[model samples]
Target: MIWETLVEPFAAYGFMRRALVGCIAVSLGATPIGVFLLLRRMSLTGDAMAHAILPGAAVGYLIAGLSLTAMTVGGLIAGMAVALFSGFVSRVTPLREDASLAAFYLISLAAGVLIVSIRGSNVDLMHVLFGTVLALDDAALILLCVVASITVIAVALLFRPLVLECADPQFLRTVSGLSAVTHFTFLALAVLNLVGGFHAFGTLMIVGIMILPAAAARFWSVSVGGMIVVAAHIAVSASVAGLLFSYHHSLPSGPAIILAAGVAYALSLVIGPVGGLARQIPSRPRTQL
Candidate 1:
């Protein structure tokens, strides 16, 4: 009975299988980046960067009418531009990094909306925002797989410098000049993941994959490697649960996945192994004699 209820849908349908594969690929690649974003205290920054890619994606839609290559390239350019510009402004001006990022993202969001309005219907815009995970074609799947491969390779190569850069940037600067390089490299990887996710989950929900799983892992693990492993598990679990929920309930897929991640995040908050609510609650100080 359990197997029929839980496993039959995926076994019966090709789309279900593809969706599962897509979500797993995304979880494996994007969740690690999410961990780093959490470590850097840049969760909101990641969100902003997610929005910052929209105008580029919208432009791609305008040019290619949803050509994966065009939109992805556009998103990459926009995301990287915003990240670099925000970093530069923080360094050169009085505006703080968060403030600069906020300003730029808002502008980008408005621009993306306006561009989409000029050429696309509400349906087209919605697809760009919400995605069609079940409808993923071969091209989309291939792109996601490629992005996952690149992300794994990049994280492995940049692990040491990135760890030093995030843990202690000032010390990294004194010890080596790769601080900026490391930072930007990580940002580029993040942008790439977001672009890949834009296909599977859309720009809005993409950040959900990146942040929620990472946040949940923090409750279960202390080490970076451990967190990555746990986060991957959480992400894969959420993706499967969300897809199942969407299928059975006839709900939208992208938001369903994010909501599933939210559920995991909520559970982590209350009962996780780390400083969860259970741990944080006082043990009712022993009564004095």
Candidate 2:
């Protein structure tokens, strides 16, 4: 049966199991961080950080081979560098955050491509760009789990301050001693999560996976915490559906996964009860006397 072809391989292959696990792990780490980034209006920074990881990953592959540990370490380093540099530029110059982020992405992408081309040979640039989840190894799965766990814990501990600062930085400054330092620290952790998911989801699709679910959740909830929970659920559901579809249909996993999220986003945009397209449409006013 066609269904058996889809279900059987996942049961038969450990790689498939690992791939599924990795997707779940990425969802856990990325979804909450995505919500915060969206609130901060730093969504583009997340995208840049995702692309910035490529050069580090390529360097890691060149030096230590294609091991997951090497690539992850490289990615983390590169992501942090980009995030820090962006922050520094924003603080020191008149350029805005989005402009700086745009510059960072282009430079990082060009650097990554140049490095990969020079190092050359067996590297699959497309894989780095789009990801291939079915090829995940046990080691990569474990790394994903570890990174997800850390991210969850970090977010949970900082939830209150982060939320307060995100919604009203000036209010937090007036009430508490929250500084730019704390803001930078939170951004750093977000960059880490984005980089952590890069290998599994790729630069091209990471922004969609990170932001779309959170954006969708915003339509369904008024409370920030509630939105985060909803976003996580949305992300997990999309990942599972995409994984299944890819398994059955022989499609690339990243695009399938992003497409699934995109559908959710579109649905939320149109039919979501609150602040959705339906609600945003100005009701026809009765003619006033």
Candidate 3:
């Protein structure tokens, strides 16, 4: 029975399989990074970096003529450069991290729009903004696999330093030297995942998938490891369910997946018994009323 449903769809159409696999791969790559981003209070940076890749993707499409490999590389490079430059500017100047991030994203957004306008038509712009998951080919799949593996390995190896930096940057810096490299590496991995997910979910909604599930998982778990595990599971489940829903209903998979993640986030915000909004609300109400 399971084979019957999957066989017809998976065998009949390669795009379906690619989309499914790519979604799952992105979740695995992104969820842990999201956890650290939240812990470090850089949640907004994730959103900013995701958007910052748009121009790079557009430029890649223009130069390489719509090749996914080129687009992914372009996005990765652009994201890393943005991360480095923002950090440098913030460190050297009086501007805060948030200010630096805002500048970076605005510049990238304008550049992306201008470049796409000059080099390609509206269809190319649509593909960059809305994405083309159904258009993914073998090369993109291979790139996703490589990126996912690197993300997993990077997370496993740097988990301790990353956590220390996120939870207590001052203490970590004082005791074990500045964890700047680890922090940058973490951001780089996150940007790569965002690029990959851009192809799956587009720039506008990638942050919803990257941060929402991880944020939701935090409400359910006190331990960081537990949160990471739960977040990854939530992301994978949402992706699979969203894909199935999109296939049956003829909806766009990216938005469907993001909505599913948003639901999970909402559920976590309200329903988790310990530290959830439900628990916090009643105590405050009892005091006031």
Considering every candidate listed, which one attains the maximal TM-score?
1
Question: RMSD to native for every prediction?
Answer: 2.0, 2.4, 2.5
Error of 3 at 238 (Å): 1.0
| lDDT by candidate, in order shown | 0.90, 0.81, 0.84
TM-score result, candidate 3: 0.91
lDDT of 3 by residue, 104-158 (tens): 8888888887888887888877778777667777777777777789999989999
Native-to-model Cα distance after best TM-score fit, residue 94 in candidate 1, in Å: 2.1
Provide the clash count, candidate 2: 0
Arrange candidates, best TM-score first: 1, 2, 3
Give the alpha carbon lDDT tens digit for every residue of 1-289 in model 1: 8887789989999999999999999998999899999999999889899999999999998998978999999999999888887778999999998888889888988999899889989987887888889989999999999999999999999999988888999999999999988988899999999999999888888999999999999999989999999999999999999998888899998899999999999999999989898876664354332
Per-residue lDDT tens digits of candidate 2, residues 5-114?
66776788787787878888988888988999899888888888888888888788778766677877888889888878888899999999788889888988988777
Q: Estimate TM-scores for all models.
A: 0.95, 0.91, 0.91
User: In model 1, what are the clashing residue pairs, if there are any?
Assistant: none
Clash pairs detected, candidate 2: none
**Superposed model 2: Cα runs more than 4 Å off:** 1-9, 282-289
